[model samples]
Target chain A: MKTDPESHQRMTQRRQEGHVKKQAAATVEKGLLIVHTGNGKGKSTAAFGMAVRMLGHDQRIGVVQFIKGALHTSERDFLGSHAQCDFVTMGDGYTWNTQNREADIATARKGWDEARRMIESGEYRMVILDELNTVLKYEYLPLDEVLAVLQAREPMVHVVITGRHAPDALIDAADLVTEMRLVKHPYREQGVKAQRGVEF
Target chain B: MKTDPESHQRMTQRRQEGHVKKQAAATVEKGLLIVHTGNGKGKSTAAFGMAVRMLGHDQRIGVVQFIKGALHTSERDFLGSHAQCDFVTMGDGYTWNTQNREADIATARKGWDEARRMIESGEYRMVILDELNTVLKYEYLPLDEVLAVLQAREPMVHVVITGRHAPDALIDAADLVTEMRLVKHPYREQGVKAQRGVEF
Candidate 1:
């Protein structure tokens, strides 16, 4: 590709201006409450990716799984084994499989207890509440209690919540929220089975 | 969590029915054209997570980055070093920095050529076209030509395209499309600058 001298100079000037603005605008440093929710894939997967990123930075992480218990995921096998990772799976299974509402509520409460401990430990730089939104939506755990613990967490400890149908209260309190809108899903449309590596 | 015998039997029966339905419904197996777009974070991050998942399954992957050139990302540094990954960065920088439309187009074309080669090689199970949507949005590469090549690629070679402002044609062609809607962004709203491991 060839570049003209004038165009190169103009681009450089504009970029410099934008850089200055960005540098000035971005000045805060604190923990972030990130929420990922929608009717699409990659919600938990993205949160796992964040765990990997934090691991890359040599930061300690805690993972509390609320709703995936029937199968062993590759992420848990790989990332859970990492030295800086403290992994805990605390769910009977999906609500559909574990028909007993009382059992599901108990499991969710147990998971939330672990999550609270992780958030208060001050050892973990990041805590991933995988599928906690679903727990919240089902009223397995009270929203006010979750919000209270989150608000009182360490100043620099980031928390990531992932699942569908995040409550309005959680959304309002979160600093970063990404709704994974489903445009197309093969399993829903093409009768495609979830594979081991790709889906798990 | 405790479960009564009656509740357990009922749950097991219901789960058996659901399993039978899933097994019967899921029959197709083929490669997927996945697109992650919109004005939210984790599009590329989610794609990278997929790469990691594929890597765990011992599959080779090809990555062609189109526009992130100015800074070194930890993902590139880590994943590029893996034996199964072929990583290539083929852009000058963002369009705003490069200002020269001709140069940007040429760079994008070169990247597309590399992407096409990776898709046709038959060696990679997955190919990630990182930030290619931005390239397409700028009309740097002809849309029809890109789609044609994608459609013609090996049936089992999954392709992941990530960026914002995806065109309608691509969405229609994709098997799985996730629009990462931006509900909240720390950089834009909370004046939180991008950190090393988090953003990269």
Candidate 2:
């Protein structure tokens, strides 16, 4: 077979291009610290996605929902069954719903106790604090204490805290911070209520 | 507010209604298992959402992406910089991209080695293994080895594996499994390439 000079040059060029392309797809070290901020629905939804992601990958995940005492969430019903995942919720519901400082404090204490253990034990790959900003916003938990827990957490642990009104200290300490501004919400409309499978 | 006998009964009825509502809410637990699968896009995007959710609750996360060599994904870049999170990747592109069986095996070994440490150490609450199914599908790593690692991993770790062609063993072992079926994709019609930020 006679090879044309131009064709031969083109083939060599293509091979070199392939080599470069392979080199370009260099593997990356995958670690993540993500923040879900915004006055919008689905922050928890997004967080659950990560939990399931880790679980699918055979990673351990721990979850604690602060100021969420209702216990009537889809996450609890589903994720709790997984041996790899542990889900806990503060039993304070909401200030608007509870309307009691003592009760909220008790709930916070219960959750805090568990959260502190996981953070210190270095037993999980991911830990989630759903609606933690509410605890900070309400001052139910001391900022310094929370900061200590975060700073002293195991080196391999990835921590995430969510809620409206993210404190300056928490934001400052965060490696990645995102603000999820409420663009538009169905709640703004009159006679509309939080629907199941979407809100709760 | 003058009290009337008939009005009093109505008020009492409303209070009872509220109590019942609260009780019903308390009986439920929110939970989910999201699986990122498909030949198209955004499996990791969905998984990242879960990580953020756990993080918002102040959950610590450990992440590992198998068969991915580059340390430049947005999630890794942000998470690696964060002290609260632990991130690790294969640092060697996929076997197809590498085109060298030995190199691919070494890459698999490197990522899995780190993952085994985190899983066994019980250091993370959640771990994400991006494109792990592909590795298993390609047989770059042994099935028994991966299964053993998963079986022996921490009880509390929530592991997530993302990619095409999840194995039966993995599916059987998973507490919750979701198959991200591709109903339609943007790439087929337009021939649009996988772009960073969107696909990576």
Candidate 3:
């Protein structure tokens, strides 16, 4: 007995109709303020993944590192070398190691300055403010000033802010916010070290 | 009136000592069951990002996509072309589109066969089971069999599972679990569509 292939056509047609309706409902187009926060891993990693996606589209990107020191991360080395990416590593190290509030604040301000320039330059389609939430959480930079700068950026420039402990105000202002909740972490529980490439 | 640089040297020395102690404490080396779940985005994207990092380390990766259709995703096209990557797209489409429980179950079983092969082949250091949780959630495949396959894989192989509605048993067995909570989604709030390179 021969089976009819046309039986699947109706299913495909219904799916197409649903998809078209959904697509038509989505009409807004503009740059977005995206936030990745909470205590889980993959916040910065996901942001860098976004950078890769943008790079695939041949779009320019700018990165400003806040609290992560000058540790040689493979992502920075790889993505930085890309012609469309402008990478900046600004902080000396984590605040605990520095132990100087004034110095940490100074470093954060400098990084913010660079981020502000990138957001306003109209050169990059996406700008990543890596660990900016940590700085904001620590109050190194005034919350209102940071928010104002973020709000006033070019309408078509996508901004990604990543770190744990994102400020409530930032969450309120973001177009997209993902909280990477820590369901489990090996470093804390199993004492497994952060492996190269996997952690860096 | 020149300041002494010796003070900063002491700080660096202390930090180095602390880091050495922490690094020395972590000695376990084995395979890991990593899960990415919840409502927000970046679950599968983060897994692909892990693939990129593993590639940077000259590692081989095998991807088994269960629920994602043969939709020409940029990630599949780009990663599948890599010399060190093996990619497979086994599903026709999402279950809603297929609208046939028996057909979906057959497709899932076929995908699971491929996944079991990859896990047992010992050729891949990292294997990604994209959207497998959805299949398990729908009971298309027996959860016990899936868990057994995952548990019995090569000792050094890292398996990453991505999707929503992951079973509690899987979560309990996982070494690491990250739940991407939806603080806010633009598609729901602003009616912004998923753009190419960003969503796919």
Candidate 4:
């Protein structure tokens, strides 16, 4: 009852092909939610990497920079020139530095509105919500509203959220999550100022 | 004229603040074109790192896998799950492996079609064209077409073309170009076959 060598080889090849097909099916689905969280400086930097990656692939991408009203960073400066990417920044500025709660909330809402439009319209394949944690931290934007918008986004639209202290609800809803733990910081110790290009 | 100590102190503080502002401005204006070209592996891996970075910052990203038609690679597997990114593959499999020349050109044309749509639409901040060199090397896709696509794309769109044998035109248009020369490969030198998670 032994199988022929030639027949066995044919069966093996068929099995291999089947496996490859199965793997392909697993990845062909659309849309995703990715979050980057931690006490490190590169959270936004990491998100920017994905933005550029998408641009190269020629997919529609929309960006909403929350709590960062200044619009004076390297990412903004360079990405502003990209035709495919839509860069939107809250004109109000930072909360800790600005020390204006009302102003922060107003700015957050403005950015959130634009983000909501992009997410709902399905005009963009991917939407990035940067420094969202800061908006959540200051309670400038409601958590429920954020969740609702994310939930309402087109089924195939991917969303990225970045910042420290990601809300538990956001984390629960996210398809993938990455947390960057900070072991040491120059600011916390010797009070060294953040360097350009590296920090921004 | 001799200045008083108080005035000197005030001037120093102002100068320091001005320096910080200048640094921020410089970072904002600094343009970049990052190329990860090489014979060694990880060009796409490094490019993916950039993708994640941009995504974290809420930058819009697009990805185009040129010669790779199969969807089972680990890189695609990981990124496929990201909700904040959009990805498109040429789906021609490998050029060297595919037997039909006309079919290969048609596949390349389809990929270039999609890539052009993404570029002209101005919807992405960065676009990653994977294994494009292999297409250029085979001449299935004309070098001028690639150049025109890059040139016509938004000036701000940061383009990254991966795979081996990058053309001189691409390198010339690129703001920053890197050549990954293979010192030693496991396949040709060690006779080790491609491994999942490592090669794919």
Best by DockQ: 1
Comparing 1 and 3 on lDDT, the stronger one: 1
Flag regions of model 2 displaced more than 4 Å: A1-33, A69-72, A186-190, B1-200
Clashes of each: 0, 90, 0, 50
Better of 2 and 4 by TM-score: 4
Instruction: List TM-scores for all candidates, in order.
Output: 0.91, 0.46, 0.88, 0.48
- Cα lDDT tens digits, model 4, A1-200, are 12354554465466667655544545334466767676643456556656665665667788888856322366786566788889988745544444445565678888889999999999887788988876786577889999998888787787878777888888788765666444233222323333333244
Between prediction 1 and prediction 4, the one with superior TM-score is 1
Candidate achieving higher lDDT, 1 or 4: 1
Give the least accurate 10-residue stretch of model 2 chain A, judged by summed lDDT.
Answer: A183-192
Residue A24 C-alpha lDDT in model 2: 60
How far out, in Å, is residue A74 in model 2?
2.0
lDDT of 1 at A194: 70
In terms of lDDT, the best-performing candidate is 1
Instruction: List fnat per candidate, in order.
Output: 0.57, 0.05, 0.48, 0.01
Report, for every candidate in turn, its global Cα lDDT versus the true structure.
Answer: 0.83, 0.61, 0.82, 0.64
**TM-score: which candidate is best?**
1
The list of candidate 3 runs beyond 4 A from truth reads: A1-20, A69-72, B1-21, B69-72
RMSD of model 3 against the true structure: 5.4
Interface RMSD of each: 4.7, 15.8, 6.9, 16.8
Cα TM-score of candidate 1:
0.91
lDDT of 3 at B191: 77
CA lDDT, candidate 2, residue B124: 72
Q: Model 4: residues >4 Å from true position, as ranges?
A: A1-25, A69-72, A186-193, B1-200
